[model samples]
Target: MSTDTSSEQRIQLRLGSEAATEELARKLASALDEGCVVGLSGRLGAGKTVFCRGLAEGRGVDPREVSSPSFVYLQSYEGDSGPFHHADLYRLGSMDDAAIEEAIDGTGLQHVLGAAGLAAVEWWEFYRGPVPQKLVTVEIAVENPEYRSIELKFAGQGLQRALDAVS
Candidate 1:
């Protein structure tokens, strides 16, 4: 993996395969602490769920148990380190801010945000609510069928450790 030094709190990685993507995510997961929120932004089929699966495996949960919570909106798993909350906001696409907040509340996503565990939200661009203090935004760009470019922006204090771990 390669890292870009454009920003201290930001790092870019080029993943050549699905396993590489998952491995990078697993490294980040190991460095994350409780109450951390990871927002994932990528086009459909960009491997957001795959990264989450790696996060689950890193946290000592069965990777097989990780899946996209598109219909249910939110799914929680018990991990060895702590809880893992996964949310998909694709269904709330283009909603107004107020409606998005309401949907977040209605779907129990509000509870997961900044909660006591590692939270990974897919299609996080749709949410406009209050962002947690411990937030990491990951934008994955699909370069080809088997390659992806991922940029991670760490917004929380002391998040450099996570970035360092990924590198």
Candidate 2:
């Protein structure tokens, strides 16, 4: 955990195994509140779904029920306190003018954001424009088959406090 010169609190964790990654995800889940949006960016097989599973588990949902929504676009699950929406936009193209318009209207993200609960969006960079201003971004990089580097950043003061507590 480190705070840069800009007062941006950045946390980096080395996940030695998938379990470690899941534990980190659970920690993140603890920091989340109702209506929280977690934006995730990573390459293929970067354990985004695994982290989401942990998040679901932390929310009292069965982790076994969580899966990548790449083909389906999004999946909604009943959480401990509210609903959880997991969205994947890997099928969508870049967020160009036309794409952004489509995403803003047709992607169903606006509805998810409007609803209460934890909304985790994978490939969030594609729809970066319409996401909430207080986005909590998580970037995961796979170093090996069993190792990952997870970086977290919060864009708002309240979220920064949550990150601090979790870190």
TM-score of each: 0.92, 0.86
- Model 1 clash count equals 0
Give a tens-digit lDDT track for model 2, residues 5-51: 13446788888998888887877776777777788889988988898
Which has the greatest lDDT? 1
lDDT tens per residue, model 1, 1-167: 43432344777889999999899889999898888888999999998999999888878889899899999999999989999999999988968778888888898888878888899999989987887888888999999999999999888665766878886
lDDT for position 61 in model 2: 80
Clashing pairs in 1: none
Candidate 2 backbone overlaps, count: 0
Q: What is the alpha-carbon lDDT of model 1 when measured against the actual structure?
A: 0.87
